[model samples]
Target: MRIAVTGSSGLIGSALVRSLLRDRHEVVRLVRRPSRAEDEVEWDPKRQYVDAAGLAGCDAVVHLAGAGVGDHRWTEAYKKEIRDSRVLGTAAVAEAVASLGTPPRVLLCGSAIGYYGDTGERAIDESAPPGDGFLADVCQEWEAAAAPAVEAGIRTVHARTGLVVSQKGGAWGRLFPVFKLGLGGRLGSGRQYWSFISLADQVAALRHILVTEELTGPVNLTAPEPVTNREVTAVMGKVLHRPTLMTVPPPALRVALGEFAQDALSSQRVIPRKLLDSGFAFEHPTVEDAVRAALRP
Candidate 1:
């Protein structure tokens, strides 16, 4: 299959690209800079520009380009950046793909579990309605931006992802260092649920979606088992053989993370109902297994 992917340099995107290539699939990387290689396609999502010719004849497109939600403190400007990056980027890719004479069979647009807002103790699947908050609004718009592809009869799938657990990058990446140094602890009350997937499973599930014709609409990319923040901290401590006694108080989290602190403290017990129903299996089904897989050399 000829697969075109945006955000190819990002943690999840890079991992998915590597997995696709290893499986002998042709991969095209969408970049903001001038095309530097045969596989590179220039695109300017903010300006709603994409090189449609470069994407001609592509079999699939995985739009993963977006600003990192946890990369910076949530200033008003940064919040806008987060929303624009996802919405504008998705719209550009969707439009470009739809314009192709023979449009791709599948368009796997990126979504997030944040769409559910705070799930609290309630476990949710794709059947659940949208929740409230900043991320939820962004996700709603982000998914809606892919209307062009869906309207064109493309098999559009929204991979609503969760907190990806990896030692290499993402929120999990930052956690490994702090925990290794014995500075690891829970944030706020540590009672909030955290839905996480190992990097390996995240890539695998994405590949599964690319070919599963029956699967469309919003499908979560989280693991089957969701654990609380306290549970995750305990697993991290056990895996690292470090003490996890420290705790970041609510006031401290708000002071350091700004509005983003609410998201960090929010509980989301998300489940990958559609993925499993589609015959996908997880290599790391448990929190301990995921932690071990991520930390393994």
Candidate 2:
């Protein structure tokens, strides 16, 4: 299949691209820069511009372009950047795909489990309504930005991803160094459930969605078993052969991370009901397996 992908340089995007290539699928990377390669398409989301003709014959398009949410502290400007990057970029991709004479069959847009806010001990699925919070609001708009494709009769799936467990980037990248140095510990009360998926499973589930015609709407890209932050810390320590006795109080995290602290301390027990129901199997379903897979060579 000929697939057009945005955010091809990001952690999950890059991995997905490699996975597709390994399976001998053609990938067209949407870039903000000049199209130096034959498989590249130039697009400017901020200007609300996309080369619709360049995306004409693609079989599918995975829109993953967005500002890094946890990359910076939650300053007002950065918060706006986060929202604009996802909403604008998604709108551009959706509109572009909608304009194509022969539009793609599927549009797998990126989303987050943050839409559920702090799930506490309760487990939630795609059937749950949107929750309240900064990230949750961003996710709501982010998913809604794909209305053009949905309205155009395209099979649109909102990939509500969870905390990805990989040594390459995201939260795990930061955790590796701190945990290796024995400085890693649970945040807040450590009771908050963390829904996580290994990098391998993340890509696999995405590929599954690309072909599964029946899987549309909000599909949580998380593992079947969601563990608490305390469980994750224990697994990390076990994998690294280190101690996990330290704890970061909620007040200290608030002082250090500002508004972002709320997210770090939030509990989201997201479940991949749609994916599993669609017969998608995980490579690493447990925290121990996820941690081990992340550290694998």
Candidate 3:
């Protein structure tokens, strides 16, 4: 199959591209700058533009380009950056896909588990209603931006992903070194639940959604088992053979992360019910499995 993917340089996108290529599928990468190669297509999300011609004949399109949520302190400007990047980027990709004479069968738009803000110990699935807070609003707008593709009769799927368990990037990337240095511990009270997925499973789930015609709308991309922050801390120490005795209070996190701290300390026990019901299997089903997978060469 021929697939076009934005955010091809990002952690999840890069891995998905590699996996597709390994299976001999043709891949087109949408870039922000000028097209530099045969498989390159230029897109400007801020301008809401994409080279529609380059996207012709693609069997599917995965829109994952967006600003990293934790990459910056939650200044007002950065918050706008986060919302605009996803909403605008999705609109561009969806509009471009919708304009195609023969649009791709599937359009997978990136989303986040943050859509369910501060779920505490409550388990959430795609059927759950939207929660409150900054990220929930951003996520709602982000997914809604893909309406063009949906209106075009394309099979649109929202990948509401959780914290990926990979050392390559995301929150886990920062945790590895700290834990390796024996400074890792729980954040805040450590009672908050953390829904996480190994990098391999994340890529696989994306592929699953691409091919599964029956699946549409919002789908949670978390593991079957969700662990608490305290549990994650224990697993990290066990996997790294380090001590996990430190703790960062909520006030400290707020001081350090600004508005983002509330999210950092928030609890979300997300479940991949749709993915599981669609017969998607996880290679790393447990937090320990995820931690060990992240450490693998």
Best by lDDT: 3
RMSD of each: 0.7, 0.7, 0.6
Would you give me the overall lDDT of model 1? 0.94
Candidate 1 C-alpha lDDT tens digits along 82-161: 99999999999999999999999999999999999998999999999999999999999999999999999999999999
Which residue pairs in model 1 clash with each other? none
Between candidates 1 and 2, the one scoring higher on lDDT is 1
lDDT (10s digit) by residue, model 3, range 205-279: 999999999899999999999999999999999999999999999998899899999999999999999999999
Which run of 10 residues does model 1 get worst, by summed lDDT?
Answer: 163-172
Candidate 3, superposed: residue stretches over 4 Å from native: none
* TM-scores of the candidates in the order shown: 0.99, 0.99, 0.99
- Per-residue lDDT tens digits for candidate 2, residues 1-297, read 999999999999999999999999999999998899889999998987898888988999998889998899899999999999999999999999998889999999999999999878998999999999999999999999999999999999999999999988988888999999998899878999999999999999999999999999999999999999999999999999999889999999989889999999988998899998989889898989988998989
Q: Quick one: ranking by lDDT, best first? A: 3, 1, 2
Report every candidate's CA lDDT: 0.94, 0.93, 0.95
